[model samples]
Target: FYIHYIASTLKILHEEGYIYRDLKALRASCAQPVYFSPFVKASNVLLVEGRPVLIDFGMCKNISKTGRTYSVCGTYHAMAPEVRALSGLDHDTRAATTSGYGYPVDFWGLGILLVELLTGKPPFGYRNGDIGDLFELSRGSPSTIHWAAGFEPSRDLRDLVESLLQPDPSKRLADWNATLNHPYFAGITDDMLPPEWDSDLGTEL
Candidate 1:
């Protein structure tokens, strides 16, 4: 259900030329005590209506074919490895290669969102309970991300999530339409998707 919802949301968001750089559960709430992100510990997810919504604008940016943005923004736990490297906060803390990173970051975040939706936690979430620790876990082997007990998501969903979590920005989802057509959303249809109220919200940049 979340994969379908996110795919639809991203479809509309990308169609409107916006990149949701910091997509996370925290962003789902309009108001909350703790900041939205995997590392920011908080309980009680209050659902507005029947569907969850993505909030926060501190890190989103405009999508461009040739535009490059550099900023240390977004929830660290939900950030793409490329964004983390660019921010100089990862374990390596080395300067990035200075390439343009935009839509790819959001796609990576979408992958994390899918994982959290299925398992009630993000793939890199660990006992460390800090942004840096989450990022470190993300840097570890792929097998580290596994579904917890009582969950049996299909392999297609898992594969799609893995594709989204790929570290290389160049290999992320091409567009929302492409994502919608992916195998993960096999039987999902437009009727099953939710509507976007913020359809006209411009890019943060």
Candidate 2:
């Protein structure tokens, strides 16, 4: 139920030239997320009418030609591999896969959420009680996904989740049209739009 909402949330962030970089279910020690540390990256959100709305943006940055940002930002489990590889502001993806980094990292988080929703816990158990190696392994291996105790995911949902978990940014789910056409999004069609908007808004809101 929540996975669909998360996927839609991610789609909007991407189209808006913003990437979540981190998405989580934790409430910060402060009333609001601290931002850019264990505080909050982009994952902080609330459910409204069965949809996810991004609630933290301190770590947010405009998409740039460099197509990357340099910071040790984001929860460990939700961190993108590219971010894990960065040393600092000099963080460079030129030598990486060249598929463009940053935002895809957040999609990785979304994948984690899908597993969690179905399994009653994260794909990998969090012994540390936080989002650590979950993101680390997610960036390196999507096969680590574990099915929930009694539930079996449809092959189609499993495939979509696997594609989102891809380690290579270039190979990750990169096409909006393709994603919309995927079986996971099948029942929901282009005609499903808000009363005041057209489906063509393309994240303009």
Candidate 3:
């Protein structure tokens, strides 16, 4: 459902530009997602009759022409490493810097979402409420994200989260097909998503 919403938004953008010639070809091509929704956290998503609906397009951007945006927007804890670097900069400095980000930023946010769901908090921050310390974590190098002590998820889950969270955009799991086939979601299909979670399993906690 999430993919469907994003894909539809991008399709609408293509239509508006009058550049959409062959819809079939456009859908078949292995295109990176063009709609960049920097803010993809839980609060921005709503559950509507068992469907996951996204809201808050105020920071949403379509990277159709230039293929990247240098604008720094989104919550720091859920923001991508690349975007996070320029978050607090002035508009002139933001444009001066060539470190623009594309669709891969969403994947980083997805990884942060997974970590937040599993552990109840984002993994990096400047001890307590300091945003500066959080910036330091993703500043100069590839950020190192680790599971908090004593919370050990299975190996497959760990691997998926790590791949999605890779600080390097090139190395991150940004492919839609690859992510759907990952071991962590092996048995799940589009028709078998969040709605199925309502089934009652025996409780142990």
RMSD of each: 7.3, 9.2, 10.6
Q: Model 2: runs farther than 4 Å from truth?
A: 26-46, 87-100, 127-140, 189-205
lDDT of each: 0.62, 0.57, 0.52
What is the overall TM-score of model 2 with all chains considered together? 0.65
Clashing residue pairs in candidate 3 are: none
Candidate 1, residues 1-205, lDDT tens digits: the string is 5456656777677667778777876665422222233343434332333354565666666665555677767766777777777766566633233464776777878788777755667777643564555554435434556576777878887778767776656665656777777887878775553444342324331
**For residue 10, what is the lDDT in candidate 3?**
38
Backbone clashes in model 2, listed as residue pairs: 22-43, 23-43, 77-131, 77-135
lDDT of 2 by residue, 1-205 (tens): 3455556666777777776666656521122222223323333432333233556667767674565666667765545556655633223434344333666777667766666545556665563663343444434555666676677889898888888767667677766566666798777753353233223324432
**lDDT, candidate 1, at 198:** 41
Using all chains and alpha carbons, the TM-scores for the candidates as numbered come to: 0.72, 0.65, 0.63
Over 1-205, each residue of candidate 3 has an lDDT whose tens digit, in order, gives 3443333443454334312111111121211221223332333333443444334445667667776777777765666666755654322222123377777776666666556545545556423464553545454333456566677979987888778777667678876566656787765554533433332333331
Instruction: Report the lDDT of model 2 for residue 198.
Output: 23
